[model samples]
Target: MHADADIPTEIQRTLTEFLDVQEQRLAELGPELAEQVQAARDATSGGKRLRPSFCYWGFRAAGGDPERPILTAAASLEMLHVSALVHDDVMDSSDTRRGAPAAHKRFEALQRARSEASGSGGDPVSFGIGAAILLGDLCLIWADEMLHTSGFDAAALARASKFFDAVRVEVTAGQYLDLVAQASGTSDLDLALRVLRYKAATYTVERPLHIGAALGGADQHLIDALSAYGLPLGEAFQLRDDLLGVFGDPAVTGKPAGDDLREGKRTVLVAHAVDHASPAQLAEFERLFGRAELDDDEIQLLREILQDSRSVQACEDLISERTAEAMEALDRSPVQDETSRKALADLAIAATSRHL
Candidate 1:
C-alpha cells in the first residue's frame, strides 16, 4: 500500500504541470479567461484519484516500466473525472464539492458580483450553468489533449485510445441512463443496477484498467482477467458510495449529510429499500425519500425505514460478496508482479471500505 500511496502524489504532480501550461495559454488570450482556468483548477484539485490509481496499477500489473511516462497518460483520466463531476454537480444542483462551492456555484457568485458592480440586470444562475457546462466541455477536451501529448509513442497511444474512447462514450451513456431512471422514478432494481454498472462501474475501474493494460501491450487473456477482477470491485465501490451518500459524515464525504436523498438519486440501496420496505414504511419512504426540503427528523425516519427493511444490511452483504469475488479473481490473476497484485488487492479493500 505504501507504493500505491504514491500514485495520488504522482497524479497531482502531473496535473499541476499540465494545468500550469493550460493557464499560460489561457493568459495569452486575456485576463478574462484567468478566472475560468482557475475554476477548472479548483474543480480538479483534491480527490481520491481512484481512476488514475487503477490505471497506474493496471499498467504495473501488465509489466510496464516503473519509470515510463504513464503518469501523464493516467492524469488524463483525472481530468475526465473532473469534467464528469462538474456536470454532475450542476445536474444535481449541488452547492458544494470537496467542502467548497461547486464549479457552477462559484461561477454564479462571480456572475453576481460582476452584475452588481456593473449595474446590469442578468440571470446569474443561468450564466453559471452555461459557463460551468463549457468548463466541463473544456476539461473533456483537455483529457484528450493530455493523453495525446503524454509523450507516449504513436503505437502505445493508439493502443490505449480505443479504451479511452469507449470509457467516454460509456460514461456519457450511463449518465443518460441515470437521468432516465431518475425521471421515470422507477424503483426497478434492474434499472438501478444498469445505471450503476454503466454510469460509474466501467469508467471507474474496468476501462481505466483496460487502457493501462493496453498501453502495456497486454494480450486479450490478461485483459479479460483484469475485467473479471475490476467489474465486481467497481460495483462494490459504487455500493459503498451509495451507503456513504446516506450515512457518511459530511466532513469526511465533503458533502452535506444525506445529499443523495435530497437529490433523489436512484441508487441500488434505495431500490432495495423500496423493494423490502413494509407497506407503511413504503408509503412513508415514497413521501419523504426524494423530498428536497426534508428535515432532520424526516431524514432520520427514512434512515430508520431503510435499516428496518434490512436494505442497509443487504447492501453491506453485497459489498462483502462482490469484494470477495474480486479478491478471488485477483488471487488467481495471471499478473506475475507480486507488488502490483498486492496493490490491486489493497485498492479493492480501500475502494469498498466503510470509511468515507
Candidate 2:
C-alpha cells in the first residue's frame, strides 16, 4: 500500500488525466464548448475528498491491495459528488461554492458578458440555469464512464456495480425529499432526519464503503459490518455540516454564516429548536428564519435562539452519540488489518470535526 499522502495525490492525478482526455475529445466541438467544460473542471476541483478515502480504506479492510485502479474507481465517486454539488447549488440558488462563483453563477456571468459584447437581448439567468443543468447531467454521465473505464477487472466492476447504482438511486430520492421538506416548510424531527439519512448520510459514507468492499469481493458479513460502522458516522458527519452551515467561518466553510438558517433548511437542529421554543420565540422564528434577506442582526438573533433553546447543544449531543456508536462498530468490525482500522478511525474523527 502507498503512504497516506499518496492517496489524494493519486486521485488528483487520475482525475486530471481523465479530464484532459475529455477536454481533448471535446476540442473538436469548438471553443464555444470550452468554457462549459472548464466549468465542470472547476466544479470538481478541491474538497476534503472524504468519499474516495473511505472507498480506499474500505477496499483495504476487505483485503484488497492498494492499487491505481481503486484510486480511479474512487475518483469516479468524486465526479458523482461534483454532479450533485453543481445541481444542488442551482436548486438552492447559491451564489458561491468553495469560495468561488458556483457553476450556474459562473455561467450566468459568462452569458452576461457575451450579451454585452454582442449587444444582444437575452436572459442571462435563464441561460446559466439551463447550461448548468446540462453540465450536471454531463458530469453524471462521466461518472458512470469513469467507473466502468477504471482499470478494475470486469468481474470486480460487476461486483461493485450494484452498490454504485444504489448510491445514485438513494441520493436522488434523498434530494427529492429535501426539496419536499423545504417546500412543505414543516419542522418535524422525523422528516428532517429522514432527509439527512438518504441525502447526506448514506451517500456520504455507507455506500462508498460498500462499493469498495464489493469491488474487493467481500462477503455479506463484511458488507453488513461496514454498514454498522458507516451509517452512524455518516449521520454524525452531516450533523456537523448542519452546524457548520449556520456557524462556520466563511473563510473555512465557503458560505455565508447562517446560510442554512437563511435557506430555512429543515435540519434536525431547526426541528429541535422549534420543538423547544417558547410560543413567542416560535412566532419570531417563523417570521425570520429562512428569509434569504435576513440581516446580520437577524442572523445573530436566530443564533441566540438556537443556543437559548438548547438546539445547538442537542445537535452536539447527537454528534457525539452517533460518533461513539460508529467507533464501537469499527472496533467490532472484522477488518483485514490493524492499519485499515486505524485509517478508518482517523477518518471518522476528521469527517465529523468542525475544523476538518
Candidate 3:
C-alpha cells in the first residue's frame, strides 16, 4: 500500500521468515515430531496469503508502523489460517490440498507403506486419522507460539488478544454450524449466510483487520469502519468460493470440480436453487444433491439448475454489490492513508473476482 509494489513482497518475506523461525523451533522438539513439523510447514506454505495481507494493510491504514511487531502479528494470522485448513481437510475428507496430497491422505499413504514394509499389520486409516489430528493440533500450538513470541510488546499483545481469541471461538462455532447445516439439509439463504459468517467470513477477513487495528489501539469508530467493510467483502469472498467449489476447474482450484456437491454443502446458491425449484426439479435435487456417486451428467444437471434458477447470477451480483459497499466503507473510514486504502481496494477486487 505504500504505492511501492514492495509492500506485499516485504510482507511475504517477513511471513516466510517467521515460519522459518517456528520450523527451527519445531526442530528443537526432536526427530520424533519431524513428520508432523514437516506437515505443518507444508500446510503453511504457498497460499494466496490473503488474511495476512489484510492484517498488514489494516495496520498500515491505521497509522501503525511497518515494523516487526505488526508484521509478526500478521504472520500469526497465516498460521491460524493454515491451522484451520489442515483441520478442514480432515473434516471434509479432502484428498488433496493446494494441488498435493492432503495432510490426512499423505499420512495415510505413509502409514500403509510403513506397515507393509515392516510386515507387521497396522490400521493405516486409524493411524492416518490420529497422526493428522496431532499434526493439526501442532499447527494450532505453533500459531499461538508465532503470536506470543513475535517480540511484540506485552501491551500490544494484550490489546490484540481479545480479538485473537475470538477467532478460535468463531472458527469452532462456524465449523459446528456447517456440520449441522449439512446434516439437517439446511437450504435457507439466511442460515447459509450465518454459517458463512461464523465459519469463514469473520475470521477470514474481518477479525484479521480488527486484530491488526486493535494492536495499534484502534478505537471503536475505526474498528467499526473496518468491520463494516470487511464483513460484506468477506461474505463476497466465501460466495465466490462457493461458486468455485461447484463449478470451477480442478486445475485452477486444486480440487475436483463439484466437490461441494459431493460434500452436500448447503451454500447460499444451493439454498437459492432449492427455494425456487419446481416440484420435479425439487425431486431431482433430492436425488442428486449429496450423492457421492454423482456422475458428470448429474453434476451438469445441477449446474444447469443453478444457472437457470438465477442463483449463479445472483451470487455474482451480490459479489459486485458487496465489493462496491466495501470500497465505499473504506472511502468513508477515518483511515487517511491513501496507499493503504488503495491496497485494500485492490484486495476487495482480488477476493471477489479471483478464479482461485
What TM-score do all the candidates reach, one by one? 0.97, 0.98, 0.94
Worst 10 residues of 2 by lDDT: 1-10
Q: Kindly report the root-mean-square deviation of model 1 from the true structure over all alpha carbons.
A: 1.5
For candidate 2, give the lDDT of residue 300: 91
- Relative to the true structure, candidate 2 reaches a TM of 0.98
Clashing pairs in 3: none
Q: On a 0 to 100 scale, what is the lDDT of residue 243 in model 1? A: 93
lDDT string for model 3 (1-356, tens) is 33354544655676567666756776787866667767776777677778888887877777887654676677788878777887888888888888889888888898899889998867988888778888877767767877788777898788888888998899989998888888897587888999989887898899999888887777889999999999999999999999999999898888888989988999988998898878788788878998878899999998888888888989899888987888899999998888888889999888889763
* TM-score result, candidate 3: 0.94
> Candidate 1: TM-score?
0.97
Candidate 3 stretches with Cα past 4 Å from truth are 1-29
Give residue 161's lDDT in candidate 2 (0 to 100): 95
- State the C-alpha lDDT per candidate: 0.90, 0.90, 0.83
lDDT of 1 by residue, 236-256 (tens): 999999999999999989898
Best to worst by lDDT, what's the order? 1, 2, 3
Worst 10-residue lDDT window for candidate 1 reads: 1-10
